[model samples]
Target chain A: MVRSGPYDLNVHCIPESGDTIEEVVAVARRLGYSGIAITNPDSMKQLPFSGNVEGFDILSGVEIRADNASKLHGIVGKYRNKVDIIAVSGGSESINRAAVENPGVDLLVNLNIAQDSGFNHVLAKEASENRVAISFDLGDLIHLKGGSRVQAVTNCRKNLLLIRKYNVPYVLTSNARSCFDMRAPRELAALAALFGMSGEEAMAGLTTIPHSIIARSRPPAGYISEGVQLVYNEADTGNIDEGDR
Target chain B: MKLLPPTLRARTRYLAFEVISQDPVRREDLIRELFSSAGSLLGDVGASECAIRLLAFEGSTGVIRCAHDRTDRTRAVLASISTVKGTRVIIHVLGISGTVRGATIKYLAGVDVFNPKDSHI
Candidate 1:
């Protein structure tokens, strides 16, 4: 049996605004989120609070927008360690350069603009070359659908195939503007289903992949302690009775 | 101006207006015109027209309030003002009470409230 893992991934954290770092941590805890990507534009400084939440982990990251491929290439090459996830804010050229230059950073590819610039092919190529993971945004997924939810699902399925084919890493995240807009785990799973994801695949998008990204972004001390060991044991033995513990 | 609808009992009403005239000064002129127009409506009812007051200009939207009794007149004045300058008007009538005020105060106390016109409620 193919084992699907937990979902752990998120994007965006605007700390410069009045929003407190604690509030962001609280929201992640309430939602059963395992990972969070702290993304403010060009701001790579550690958040005022520790990235480690009470129950979840945080990945320090940023979403940067460059004017062109060359500029993006320069930024990624220069500050790869400064960010955990390098999301190209917009522009296909920037994304392409990011994929090529900072091969380690997880690429949160916006499918809407990427497809327009024929960057998806290059994105897929780079993912394979660098062993870097990728995730297509639902906003772009929605935009590509052009108001038709069904079409959006079909497009997402095709996009997933490309990810699988290229062996690019992938995850799921709601591009929420406010705390009220964040989705619960079950809701995110349901959304993934619309993209032709199986229950296990959907679960992984929300859990394991996100966890992996967070792990790579920030290596927290004692992260693989007893709790994580217990989880691993449960996965191995199919005795998830203590999974919630 | 008509009377407040029974549905809007005990509600605080906010009047919103947009500038339509191409002239740069016309927008400010229209705002002044609206204040005067509101005064006239209150005068017709024999109520204290002085109570009808301009509160503040919230971005492109304006806020005016009186005791809830003149809601209809407020709406009418806003509509008439729209007609005079060919600008569009949006009237947001909200039911404000202890519960609403508490929620508003709690949510707004720390946050910088961007007067987005639509979020007044």
Candidate 2:
């Protein structure tokens, strides 16, 4: 069985319009979260993090939202190194295309909000290659109802089918602006079920997917690419300073 | 008229949920919103068949009853609500069980707001 207490990757925090980082942590723990990424604006990314808050993992993140593609490229290039998670807001078809095509974008949120999912077979293939995750912002489902909500969910269903078929990474987030906006993990799973995901699949979207994203974000140790880190015993490799001299 | 046979009666589900808001939520407003959301989402015929009933509301906690087949739709309606009486609010579903006793005793038993010692918070 998948473990509960899913992670939220798109919470607005600190110096912005959302809840303070401390308040978010306090309320998230009470709501039974395993970990959370406080994805504030890029300006807040430079602010230091306190390792872990109350034993819950708190990852610092940045979200880039510009109407034009060049600005998005510039912002992602600057903040990709600075934050643990990088999310690009998806609204226009162009923004969606730019976000998934760029290698630096860790997540693309709001893909299906304004129109379609902003991804066709070609775009879906590129996103899969780049490992850019697509997030279903629960706030959309919460705030929009009637026909608009129906349209959003229908679009999400279409997106989900393509995501699964093409092997694109995907996640679920509340995009919570306040402590009160967070939902219980169980509730989120139920909502995902309505969008054509199984309960286990929903749990994976909440838990495993985010966990793996964080894992991928970590820099490889020993300063080497895949399958190529050199090692030597301390006794054998000692006196490197003297050897250089 | 005699009551319908046990097997003929609708199998119901109890949904335990919590309301996170700055102000106390009145029962009338909660009822109105439930029907309003159900109606808007599922339309008149679907909402009419939902058979929603507000079982209880204690502070931030509540238990709602709906038909077995309509539980998923009812949960979506619960998720769709973001406000009550102009105050912004979020409704979190705790769990769903077949009986009221199961919903309250198993799910809502330790959900008391006053008891900080309760671990389920």
Categorize the docking of model 1. Answer: incorrect
lDDT of 1 by residue, A1-245 (tens): 11133333445555544344455555544445655666666644545333444445666566666666657767766557666666656456555546545655565555444434334566677766875656645533322323353444555677677776776667776554433334445445545654566667766666676666556655665466435643365456876566577
Instruction: Output the worst ten-in-a-row residue range by lDDT, candidate 1 chain A.
Output: A1-10
lDDT tens readout by residue for model 2, B1-121: 9999999998899998878676778988988988887777678887878788889997888899999987867877787677887876777778889998898887887774521112232
Residue-level lDDT tens digits of model 2 in A3-28: 24589888876677545667677667
Task: Give the Å error, residue A24, model 1.
Answer: 3.0
Best by DockQ: 2
lDDT for residue B65 in candidate 1, whole number 0-100: 55
Interface RMSD of each: 17.0, 4.9
Cα lDDT, model 2, residue B36 = 86
TM-score attained by model 1: 0.51
Error of 1 at A100 (Å): 4.8
Worst lDDT window (10 residues) for model 2 chain A? Answer: A45-54
